[model samples]
Target: MARRRKGRAISGVLLLNKPTGISSNKALQKVRAMLFASKGGHTGNLDPMATGLLPLCFGEATKFSSYLLDADKAYIACARLGQVSDTGDADGEIIHERSVPELSIEQLQQVMQGFVGAIEQVPPMYSALKQNGQPLYKLAREGKTVERKARPVTIYSIELINWQAPDLTFSVRCSKGTYVRTLAEDIGEQLGCGAHLISLHRTHTGGFEAAEMISMDQLQQVRDDEGSIDHYLLPADILVSHFAKKNLSAAETARILHGQDIANTENLTGMVRLYDPEQQFLGLAEASETGRLMPRRLIVTDETVTD
Candidate 1:
């Protein structure tokens, strides 16, 4: 017999304001425990030294977590100019240093403009990227340096926020998989002074901003008050809010949930948001060019019928 997991089969997304000094998974665990949720997942990872917005998915919301993971992210980073760290961030040991030249804000902005577009970046060794099924950070901890290919990533925008001697702060909106530490290092290299990120904070990801984020302390207060934290959770379908919404008849809903593909002739030719007659979110379906609405991830068995 299969053993079932314990806890509430709740479904929704939590916009957590992740704290520094804890891994993303650890933060998720804390939130999951508070909610007593049986299943939970984080959209993407944030380094222990980083903080700010981290979207967490519980139950059925996990099905659409990938969409947020693949979405663009924005961050504000503090860089220590004239110093280079082996890990490209403050958490690593300093390996090199150089003199920093005094510069005007205009000059700095001009240099930053050059980076506000598509650019190739080499992932830092102290990263989670895998090689031979082993995380690169593991190899780094053992003092090993391996060749890494420079990957193309778009920096939609980059602007200087503050400049105080060797410690400079900047904000950037970039495509997924971008390493802000590498960006700081690259910018330093351009100015003839090496640099490494001192701190980083994600302010925006997917279509969410930091404004809606809840802190662990606030959650604990609510829990102490014996309140339902479920109220803090966003609907599961919020993950796929960009998809075209389609309301299905009771018969169509039943057929779709039963692993059947219905006709998709509503001018939607991609992933579509599905809703039952009562307007409860069903799940997502892929609409093909051949006019078939194929069930992809359904909520019928996902334990929560999010409204």
Candidate 2:
């Protein structure tokens, strides 16, 4: 006998304040079960030892995850100046430890300047990046080290918040794929000492900030009180605000909904925000060299559907 399933309609994002020591996937699953959502995914990952805002996309919003993934991120990290770890953060075994140098605030500030602007970084071994169809962390667990190519990433801003005995707390605004652990290690090496990240917290990614985030407990409370959870969602187009806007006529909107490439967009080159005749957000599109707007990610045809 086939089991009949009840239709579950859940869509939109839940901004979760992920606590330290919980994996991003675990948090996503917990939120999924709480919402009873059929489809759910996270836009970006926060490491197990890292805490703070993790955007979980559910239902139709999951389709536009790439936009969120590519957005820039902000973090606050504490670096232990006298230690190095296999996993780069505090969770792993200490591979090496040394005495921290007497670092003055000014000297630390000077060192931080070198990291601003564009910089090259080698990905940490304790990461999800795959090589030869296997995760690099798996190889690292076996005490094997592999050559990793340095990737170019921009550090939009880095500020030293405080300096204490053997720890330094700082905030960073960086492009996607920037590793705070690697940055800490590199800073330590430059200062003639080795270091590792002791703590990490993502404060923002794209337009999503920790201040505006809701937790799993809060979502559960909302569900219990209202008999529905409806207040946790942000507009899907929030991550694509950096792109240019292109409003389409009703005819164009109909054509686009039918998967027809739009022609005659004016002076657009990169990812563009699309709006329909009713001023409703459609999705993202790219302007072709021939002046056609090609759809990249379309979430829903009706903007009011988010509610």
Candidate 3:
């Protein structure tokens, strides 16, 4: 294993309460510059109009980012009824509008119930999905259309937060890769009224919550405190607590470092968190057979690889 130097490049996870109007990558860049991280990456992408929990990995922690991207997410989003946007969000122009029909709470509640559970959704044209050599958004900008297949997605829970006039706010907990904008459009279609997202705030992702996130102002305060900025960072395994843990002895650690699989521990199944004797995070591994843990991903040096 490569030894990390102190004050060179910090390693760990930064839970950022991403503010609205900033793309997820842009937010990562800002945090990277603030920490002066030599390497960094975010688990998932949040739209520019959305705000909330965005977990950023710095230095060696970037190796484990893929696991975070696979976790579920929760968000609070407001959708405007009787109005349809070209981009399915407030950033798009309103291309269609109609008067809000008299909708009773019970009737609206019934429509929401139908949206629960597993469903297939066709991705919107104004998405980052790539086709041929260009992004779908580029085609949408040029007034071109293409057939998009529906993808299966799951909704764990959705609750109506509040509603007044044409504005309806709802909280949704869904699997990763789900599109809340598409959900809003589908809900509108079910209600016989077009809709689009007006505001979106993610509350949770990859087991990280907004309440645990630090703001840019708080980070600045820590930075100005002289040398305590590193104290604000959480351990890289924070989000991986959901997985089982395996403590490796010196011999086992040596074997793993040599890329050899060891006998699995009984009762251990699925992905697990691997640690050194001192409980320092080593990386991630999967349990196979009755007694063997095979390395799935390891935290190597921060040498960037390009094709």
Candidate 4:
């Protein structure tokens, strides 16, 4: 028999303003400890050098984190010109340096525009990417270099936010798997000078926005003021807000809860956020073309949650 996790079975999502100098997992652990939640997970990782919106899911919300992980992301990235780092960011050793050229915003925009579409981006060596079951970062730390195939990544836009001296800042909306650090290095190379990421701040990921993010201090204040932080958490269904919503009658909900398929009358198909007639969130279901609604994932209790 497996041991059950001991803590509050609290289920919801927290938009954390992840501070720099800590790993995403570390930030998750801190918030989980504050909430006393037994389970917690993050949608995507923000490098220690980067800080911004990091969505932390707890309890049943962890089940839908993959949807947020696959969602698009936006970041405010600042790169320093005339230098290249081994890790492609300020965290690594500088291996190359050169004088920066006097460049106009127009020239910078034109060069950045070249990357604002379907393009190839090579993942950085100090990244969490794995090869031969070992993380590439581990090999990088061991003074090893390996050939990495360029993968297709879409940069929806790279809007130049500022260009002050040797520092250049831009906001990028990109598809999943786009590495902003690599993009900065490529831009520097295009300008005939080397470059490296100095700072990166994520502003958006999936449906969550910067406006929804709460810093660690803010969270502590909330707990200090209110008796509990539970009111601040968004419902778990918000993680899968992309899914179509369907309401089930009491009888249908009962049948589905008992692990039985029910007939679909609304002709809905694909994954859906299933709710009880009273608007309580039940979990998820898949409606097939054959007009059958099958259980995909369900909460363990009748007193789970409402939409």
With a 3 Å backbone cut-off (N, CA, C), the pairs that clash in candidate 2 are: none
TM-score of each: 0.96, 0.89, 0.91, 0.96
Candidate 1 local lDDT, 189-285, one digit each (tens): 9888989999999999989999999999899999999898899999999999988999999788888877788888687878999998889998899
Residue 175 displacement in candidate 2 (angstroms): 1.6
The Cα error of candidate 2 at residue 122, in Å, is 1.6
Which ten-residue region of model 2 has the weakest summed lDDT? Answer: 298-307
The lDDT per prediction is 0.91, 0.85, 0.84, 0.91
lDDT of 2 by residue, 1-307 (tens): 9675333567777889998888999999888887777788898789999989898888777877777888899999999998898888899889898888888899999998899999999999888999998899999988888999999999999999989869999999999999999999999888878899999989999887888988777777887787666567766666667789888998888777766689854878888888998887787788888888887777665532332
The lDDT of model 1 is: 0.91
Q: Give the TM-score of candidate 3.
A: 0.91
Q: Which lDDT tens digits does candidate 3 get at residues 59-150?
A: 77887888888899999999999999999999999999988888887877788878889999899999888889889999999999999999
Q: CA lDDT of 166 in candidate 1?
A: 87
lDDT (Cα, tens digit) per residue for candidate 4, span 77-98: 9999999999999999899999
Q: Give the TM-score of candidate 4.
A: 0.96
